[model samples]
Target: MPAPASAPAPAPPSPHPLRTRPFRLLFAGRTLSLLGDAAIPAALALAVQEATGSTAALALVLACSMVPKLLLLPLGGVMGDRFDARTIALAMDLVRCVTQLVVGVQLLGGTPSLAVIASVEVIGGAAGAFATPTAAPLVRGTVPEAGLQRANAAMAVAHSASRVGGPALAGALIFTVGPGWAFVLDAASFAVSAALLCAVRIARVERPAPGARPSVLTDLREGWREVRTRDWYWSSLIGHSAWNGAAAVLMTLGPGIAVHRLGGGAAWVALLQTGAIGLLLGSLVADRVSPRRPVLTANIGLATYALPLLLLAAGAPAVVVIGAYGLAQAGLGFLTPVWETAVQRAVPEHALARVTSYDWLLSFAAMPLGYALAPLAASTWGPGVPLTVAALVVAACCLGSALLPGVRRFTGGPDPVAPAGAEAVSLPGTR
Candidate 1:
C-alpha cells in the first residue's frame, strides 16, 4: 500500500495576542473607549455642579448614567451570545457617539436644566449597558488559551494608560476650553473607537436557524444554571458586589472632598488619575508572573484597597491620598488580568458573556445605592463618616472573600488543578 501522507504539523503557536491583527485593532478600540470613559466622570460632575449648583442634581445625573447600565446589562449579555459581539459593540458606540455629540452641543450652547442633562445621560447609559457585556466575550475569543493572561495584561496596560492620561486631559480641557469641549472630544473618541472596532474580527458560535433559536428565557436560565453550578463564581460575585457598594463612595464624594476640603481643583483630577500608575505597574508584573492559584493570589492582594479611603477620611494631604490610591488600585490592577483569565478558562466559551452579565449585574447592583446614600450620610455625619464606612466595608469584603473555600484553590484553566509539581493549596474543605 502507498504510504499514507502524514498530517501536517499544527501551525506554530503565536507568541502573543498583540501579534494578531484582530487583537491589535481591538486593543486600539478599547484604549480609545476607556479614554472617553475616564474623562466622562470628571466632565459630567463639573458640568452638573456648574449648571444646577445642587449636589442632589449631580447625584441624579450620575445615577441616570449608572441605573440604565445596571438595568440593561443582562440583555446586553444575551445580545453578545446571540449575535456578533463586534457588531453589537460597534452599533452601541455609534449611538453613544451621537448622544455625546448632541450633549456637547447643548453644554456649549448654554447650561441646560438638570432634567435635560439627566435625560441625556439616561440614553447614554443605556447604550453603555448593552456594550459592556460584549467586552468579555470578545476578549475571551480573541487569542489562544495560553495567551489569555498576556492578552488581558495588554488590555490592562492600555486601560491604565488611558486612566492616567484621560483625567489629565479632561481636567485641562475642562479648566481651559470648558466642559463643552470635553464632551465633544469624548464623542470624537467614541467615533474613533467604533471605527477601530468595526475593523477587528472575532469568531462566534453560530446560533441555530432563526426558527430553531433558543428563546431569551431559555438562554437566561441556562446562564443562571451555569452560575449556580460554580460555587467559586457565585461567591466571588457576592464579594465583588459588597466591595462595589463601598467603592462607590469614592465616586460620590471623592472629588468634592478633594475640592472642598483638600484645596483641590483640576489638580484633584490629576492626583486621582495618577493612581492608575499602580495599575500600569501591576500589569507589567502580570506580564511576567504566573500564579498557581490565581484567584487566591488575587484575593490576598486586593485586600489593601481599603487604604485610600482610610487615609482620605483621616484628612491626608493630596500627595498622601494619591499614594494610597495608587497602592489600592495596584492590587485591583493585578487582580484584573488574572481574574479575567481564570474566568475565561473556567467557563465554556459560548456561555461566558451571559455569565459575565450576571457578574456585572451583581457587582454593580449596589453602586447606585451607594451613590444615593453616601452623600446623604456625608451630609448628616460629615463626609469623613462615609469615607470611613467605605474603608471598613472594603476591608471586610476583601478579607472575607479570601476565606471562601473554593477561592483558595482556584488555579484557573481547563483542569482547574494545581500546576505540575505544586501540591494543592489548603482551603477550608481541601482533602
Candidate 2:
C-alpha cells in the first residue's frame, strides 16, 4: 500500500511593525472616539440631573449604558474572531454617531422625556458592545512582536488623553452652549473617527477551520475553558476584576462624598481628574524608561494607587487630595501599557479576542453592581468608611494578584520572528 499522506504543516506567522500606516490610522481613530466617549458621560449625567433632580435616576441612566456592554462583551468577542473587525468598528461608529445626534437634537429642542434619553443611551451602549471587542484584536495585527510594547504604550497615552480632555471639554461646552452642544460635539467626533477608519485598509489573516457550530452557552464555556488553561490569564483577570470593582465604588461615590461631605463639587472632581491627567503624561514616557519589565513595573504601580485613597480617608485638604490622586493616576497610567502588552504577548492570536472579551467582561461585571452598592454602602457604613474599604480591597487584590506564580514569573520577553512552517493567527474585525 502507498504511504499515507502526510498532514500539512502549519504556516508561519508574518512579521509586521508597530509603526505601520494602518495602525497609526486606527490609533488616531480610537483616540478621537474615546475623547467623544468621555464627553458624553459627563454631559449626559448633568442633563439627567438637571431634568430629574434625582441622583438615583441619573445612576440608572449610567447603569443602562454599562449593562449592555457587560452582558454582550463575550458575544462581541466571538463576533470579532468570526468576522472582519474593521467593518464592525466602522458600523459601530456610524451607529453611535446617529445615536448621539438624536440625543443632541432631543436635548437642544427643550428637554425630551427621561424615557427617551434612557432608551437612546441603552441603544448606544449596545453598539459599544460591538465596537470594543472588535478593536481589541487590532493592536496585535498592526504591530510586530518587538513593537507590541511601544504600540500599547502609545495607545495608553491616547486613552489617557481622552480621559483627561473629555470631561474638561464637556464641562466647558455645557457651561457655554448647553449640554446639547456637547452631545453635538461628541457626534461630530465619532463621525470623524468613522471616516478615518473607513480610509484605512487592514489585511486579513486566516482563521482556524470550524468544526461544529457551538451554542452560545457552549461558546461561553469554551472561552472559559481557554482561560482556565492559561496561568497568566486567570491571574490577570482576577487582578483586574478586583481593581475595577473597587474603582467602580470609588468613582461612583467618591465624587459625591467630596462634594456633599467634603464641601467640594465640580471643581474638586476636576482637580482629581487633573491628577489622573498627570498619570497619562507619565504613561507616555513609560515605554522609554522600562521597555522589558512591564509586568513587574505595573505591579509596583498598582500598589501606589492605595496611597491616595488612604490619604483622602484621613480628610486631607483639597490640594493634598488632588496631589495624592494625581500620583495614583500617574502610577496607573504607567501600568496600562505594560499590562496590555503582557496580555497581547501571552495569548494566542486565534484566541485573543475571546480572551480579551472575557477579561473585559469579568473586570466590568462588578461596575454596575458597585455603582448600585456605593450609595447603599455609604448609607450603611458612613461616607468615608465605604471609600476606605474599597481602597483597601483594591490594594489587597493588587498585592494578591502580583503574588500569583504566573503573574510574578511570566515574562513575555520579545518574541522571536516566526520560523517557516508556523501557523499565523488572525485578529478579529475592528468593528
RMSD of each: 7.2, 7.7
Cα error, residue 110 of model 1, in Å, equals 3.8
The runs of at least 3 residues in candidate 2 whose Cα sits more than 4 Å from the true structure, single-residue gaps closed, are 1-19, 208-213, 256-263, 413-431
The lDDT values for all models are 0.79, 0.74
Error of 2 at 293 (Å): 3.9
Q: Candidate 1, residues 1-431: lDDT per residue as tens digits?
A: 99999999998865888998888988888888788778888888888888888888987887798889988888888778788788989999899898888878888988566777788899998998888888877786667677889999998888888878887888899999888888898888889989998787676554657788788988888778777766677777766776677778887788888888778776476666667788888887887788998887876667676788888899888888888788777887888888888887787666778889998898889787787899999999998898888878777766776677777767786535422322221112211
- In candidate 2, residue 47 scores what lDDT? 83
Weakest ten-residue segment in model 1 by summed lDDT: 422-431
Q: What is the lDDT of candidate 2?
A: 0.74
lDDT of 2 at 408: 65
